[model samples]
Target: MPFTLYMLALAVFAQGTSEFMLSGLIPDIAADLQVSIPAAGALTSAFAAGMVVGAPLMALLSRRWPRRRALLVFLIVFLLVHVVGAVTTDFGVLLATRVVAALANAGFLAVALATAAAMAAPGATGRATSVLLGGTTLACIVGVPAGAVLGQEWGWRSAFWAVAAVSVPAVIAIMASVPGGPAGAGARGAGGELRALRRPRLLVALLLGALVNGATFCTFTYLAPLVTGVTGFGAAGVPVVLALFGLGSFVGVTAGGRLADRRPRPLLAVGGAALLVGWVVFALTAGNAAATVVLVLVQGTLSFAVGSTLIAQVLYAAVEAPTLGGGFATAALNVGAAAGPWWGGVALAAGFGYRAPLWVSALLVAVALAVGGAAEGVRVRRRAAGGAGEAPAPAR
Candidate 1:
C-alpha cells in the first residue's frame, strides 16, 4: 500500500469520527437544545440523508476535477461545518449543520475511494479499500468513545470542536501527500453514469451493498439496549461490548480484503451466511451474557467481511466510471444506514423485544445472499456462453 492510501484513511477517520460522535452526544444535545431525545436522534438520520444525496451530487460536480483537489475542497467544507455546529445552540441550526457536514463527508469518501482504487497496484483494489475503511472501524473503537467522554466531561459542543480540530491535520496531510492530477478523469459524465446504474447486474451489486449494511445496522443500532435489557449487563459495560465489536470489525475488514482480492464470490456467500447464522444465534441466546458477547463479535466480523466484498463487487461492476461507482456505493450504503434503524424502530414500537432487530437483521442478510447468488449465476452463465476461450468476469 502507498503512503497516500494511509493519508486517505486518516481523512476518513476524521470524518467518520464526526459522523458517529453524534450517537453519544444525543442526550446532551437534546437537554441543551430543549428537545426530546428522539428529536436529537434525528440529527443522525439527517446526516445519513445528506450522504445519500451528496454522494452522486458531489461525484457529478467534481467529475472533471483532479481527485486530490476534490478531496481537499470537501475536507475544508467539512471542517467549516463542524466549527459552525460547535457554536450553534439552536436545534434546527445544529441539524442543518449536521447535514452540511455529512455532504462534505460523503464527497470526501467518494473521491477518496476512487482515488485509492486508481492508485493501488494491479489486483489490490480490495486491499486498498480495506485499508481505507479501516479508518472508519478505528473511529468506532477509538474516536467515538473518546468523543463521548469529551462530550460528557466538557459538553456536547466540545465534541464538535474536537472533530474540527482533528480535521486540520487531515487537511494538511492530504495537501502534502496526495498527488494532484485528473485521476479517474476518463469516467463518463453524469448522464452516462446514471444510465450505467440502470443495468440489472450493477443495480444488484449496489443493492447487495445496501442490504449488507442494512442488515448490520438493523441489529447494531439497538445493540446497547439489547446488551443491558437482554444480557443484563450494566450501563458501563455497553462501551466495552461496542469496542469488542469494533475490534472484530477491524480484523474482519483486514482479512476480508485479502480474501476479496482472491475470491470475492465465495467470500460474499460465506460471509453473508455467517452473518445470518450469527444473527439467528444471537436472537436465540441473547439472554446469556457470554453467548451474547461472542455472537456480537461474530456478527461484527461477518457483517464487515461481507461489506468489503460487496464494495469491491460494485467497483468492479462500475469499472468504467470509478468515481461514480464509488458514489453509488456510498449512497446505497447510507440509504441502508438510514433505513435499517428506522425499520428496527418500527419493530420495537410494535412491541417486539430488543432481540427482534436481530431477527430482522437475519432476514436482510438472507436476502443479500440470494441476491449475491443470482449475481454469481449471471456471471457464470455469461462466462459459459462466451466459451472457455474468453476470460471470465472478475469474481466480484
Candidate 2:
C-alpha cells in the first residue's frame, strides 16, 4: 500500500475509535450528563443519523473538487468537530459536535475510498480499496480499546481529546503524501453523476450492505445485556469478551482483503454463511460464558470479513461516481445502524428472550445471502454480454 493510503487509514482509525468508544463510555456519559442510559445512547444514534445525511450531501456538494483537497478539508472538519466534542459539557452541544464529527468522518472515508481506486494500478483496485477500509478493522482492535481505557481512567472528554490529537499527524501525512491533480479522468461530476443512482446493480449492493449491517448491529447493540443476563456474569467480564470480538474482527478484515483480491465471490458467500452460523451459535450458547465468547469472536469476524467486498461491489456498480457510491454505502450502513437497534429494542420490549435479536440477525443474513446470489447471477450475465474491454463486475 502507498504511504498516502496509510495516512488515510490513520485518519479513519481515529474516527472509528471516536465512534465505537462511545459504547464503552455510555454509563459515564449518562452519569455526568444526568441522563438515562438509553438517552445517553441517543448520542451515538445522533451520530449515525448525521452520517446518513452527511455522506450524500458532502458527496454531491464536493463532487467536482480534487480528491486530495476534499480529503484535507474534511479531515480539518473532523479535527474541529472532535475539539468541540471534547470541550463541551452541555448535552445539546456535545450532540451537535457528534453530528459534525459524523459528517466529516463519513465524508472523508467516502472520498478516501474513491482516491484509493484512482491511485491503484488497473488490476489492483480491490487491494487498494481494502487498504483504506482496513483502518476500521484496525481501529476496532487497537483504537477503540485504548480509547475505552482512556475514558475509563481520565474521563470521556480525555478520550475525545486523544482522537483529536491524532488528526494533526494525519493532516501532516495527508498533505505531504497525497498528490494533487485534476478530478479523476473517468469519474463524472454533479448533475451528470446523479443518474448513476438509477443502476440496479448499485441499488443491490447498497441493500446488501444495509441488510448485513442491520443484522450485525441487531445482535451487537444488545450484546452486553445478553452476556450478563444469559451467562449471569457481572459487568467486569463484558469488556474482555468484547475485546475478543474486536480481535476476531481484525483478523477477518485482514483475511478478507486477501480473499477479495483473489476470489471475491467465494469470500462473500462464505462470509454470509458464516454470519448465519455465527448467529445461530450465539443464540444457542447465550447461557455459556465460554461458548458465548467463542461465538462473539466468530460473529465479529464474519460481520467484518465481507466489508471490503461489499464496498467494492458498490463502487464497481457506480463507476461513474465512485465517491458517491462509497458515500451511499456509508449511508446504507448508518440506516441499518439506526434500524438494528430500534428493532432489537422492540424485541426486548415485547418480552422476547434476550437471544431473540440474534435469531433475527440470522434471518437477516440469510436474506442477504439470497440477495447476493441474485446479484451475482446478474453480474455473470452482464459480463457474458459485455465486450472483452468492459470493466469487470464489482465484488459483493
Candidate 3:
C-alpha cells in the first residue's frame, strides 16, 4: 500500500472518531442537554442526514478539482465544525454543528475512496478501500472508547475538543503527503456520472449498502443503553464493551479486504447471514452479560465484513464514474445510518425494550441479503451470456 493511502486513513480516523464517538456520548449528552435519550440519539441521525445530502453534492462540486485540494478543504471545514460543537451549550446549536461536520466528513470520505481506488495497484481496489476504511474500525477500537472515558471523566464537549485537536495534525499530514493530482482525471462529468447511476445493478448495490448500514446502526446507536440497561453493566462498562466491538470490526475489515476482490458475492451472502444470526442471538440473549459481550463482538465482525465488498461492487457497477460511484455509496450508507437510529427511537417510543432494535437490525439484514443475492444472480447471468465463466474478475 502507498504512504498516501495510510495518510488518507489517518484523516478518516479523525472524522470517524467524531462520527462513532457520538454513540458513547449519548447518555452524557442527554443529561447535559436536558433532553430524552431518544432525542439525544437523533443527533446521530442529523449527522447522517447531512452526509446523505453532502456526498453527491460535494462530489459534484469537487469533480474537476485536484483530489488533495478537495480533501484539504473538507478537512478544514470538519475541524472548524468540531470546534463549534465543542463550545456550544445550546442543543440546537450542537445539533446543527453535527450536520455541518457531517457534510465535511461525507465529502472527505467520498473523495478519499475515489483517490484510494485511483492509486491502487492493479487488482487491489478492494484492499486499498478496506485499508482506508480500516481507520473507522481503528477509531472504534481507540477513539470511541477514549471519547467515552473523556465524556465520563470530563464532559461530552471535551470529546469534541479532542477530535478538533487531533484533526490539526491530520490536516497537515494530508497536505504534506497526498499528491496534488486530479483523481480519475478522465472520469465522466457530473451529468455523465448521474447517468451511470441509473443502472439497475448499481442502484441495487447502493440500496444494499444502505440496508447493511441501517441494520448495524439500529442497535448500535443505542448500544450504550443496551450495555448499561439490558446487559446489567454500569456506565463505565460501556467503553469496554464498545472496545470489544471495535476489535471485532478491525478483524472483520482485515479479512474482508483479503477476500472481497476474490469472492465478493459469496462473501456478502455468508457475511450477511452471519450478521443476521448474530442479531438474532443478540436479541435472544440481551439479558446475559457474557452472551451480550460475545455477541457484540460477533455482530461487529459480521457487519463490517461485507463493507469493502459492497463498496467494490458499487464501484464495479459504476466503472465509468468512480467519484460519483463513491459518493453514491457514501450517501446510500448514511441514509441507512440516519434512518436506523430514527427507527430504533420509534421502537423505543412504541414501548419496545432496548433489545427491540436488534430485531429491527435482523430484518434489515435479511432484506439486504435477499437484494445481494439477486444482484449476484444478475451478475452471473450477464457474465454467462457474454461467454464469461464464473471466475471472479480482477479488481479494476
RMSD of each: 2.1, 2.7, 3.0
How many steric overlaps does candidate 2 have? 0
For model 1, how does the per-residue alpha-carbon lDDT over 175-272 read when each residue is reduced to its tens digit? 88787877466667768777866666668878888887898888878999999999999999999999988888888888988987888767777677
TM-scores of all candidate predictions against the true structure: 0.95, 0.92, 0.89
| lDDT by candidate, in order shown | 0.84, 0.79, 0.83
Question: Who wins the lDDT comparison?
Answer: 1
lDDT tens digits by residue: candidate 3, 1-396: 988788788878888899888877999899988999999988987887788999988877887789889899999999998998888778999889989888889888888888888888867788888898899989989988789889989999999999888888868877887878875577877778789788777787788888888988788788989888898999889878878888888888888888887888678877888888889999999999999999998888878888667877777766778777888889988888878877888998899899889999998999888776766676678777994422222234
Per-residue lDDT tens digits of candidate 2, residues 1-396? 788888888898888888888977899988998889998888888888888999888876667778778888999988988888888778888888888889988888878878887787765667777777677777777888888889989998888889989878889987887867633336776666778766777787688888888887888788888988997779998777777777777777777766666677677887788888888887988999788888888888878777566777777677788778778878888888788777888888899889889988888888888887876776677778883222223632
Candidate with the larger TM-score of 1 and 2: 1
In candidate 2, the residue pairs with backbone N, CA or C atoms under 3 Å apart (3 or more residues apart, or in different chains) clash, namely none
- Candidate 2 wrongly placed segments (more than 4 Å): 33-39, 182-185, 377-396
Candidate ranking under lDDT, highest first, comes to 1, 3, 2
Off by over 4 Å in 1: 387-396
Residue 154, model 2: lDDT of 96
Of 2 and 3, the candidate ranking higher by TM-score: 2
| Ten contiguous residues minimizing lDDT sum, candidate 2 | 387-396
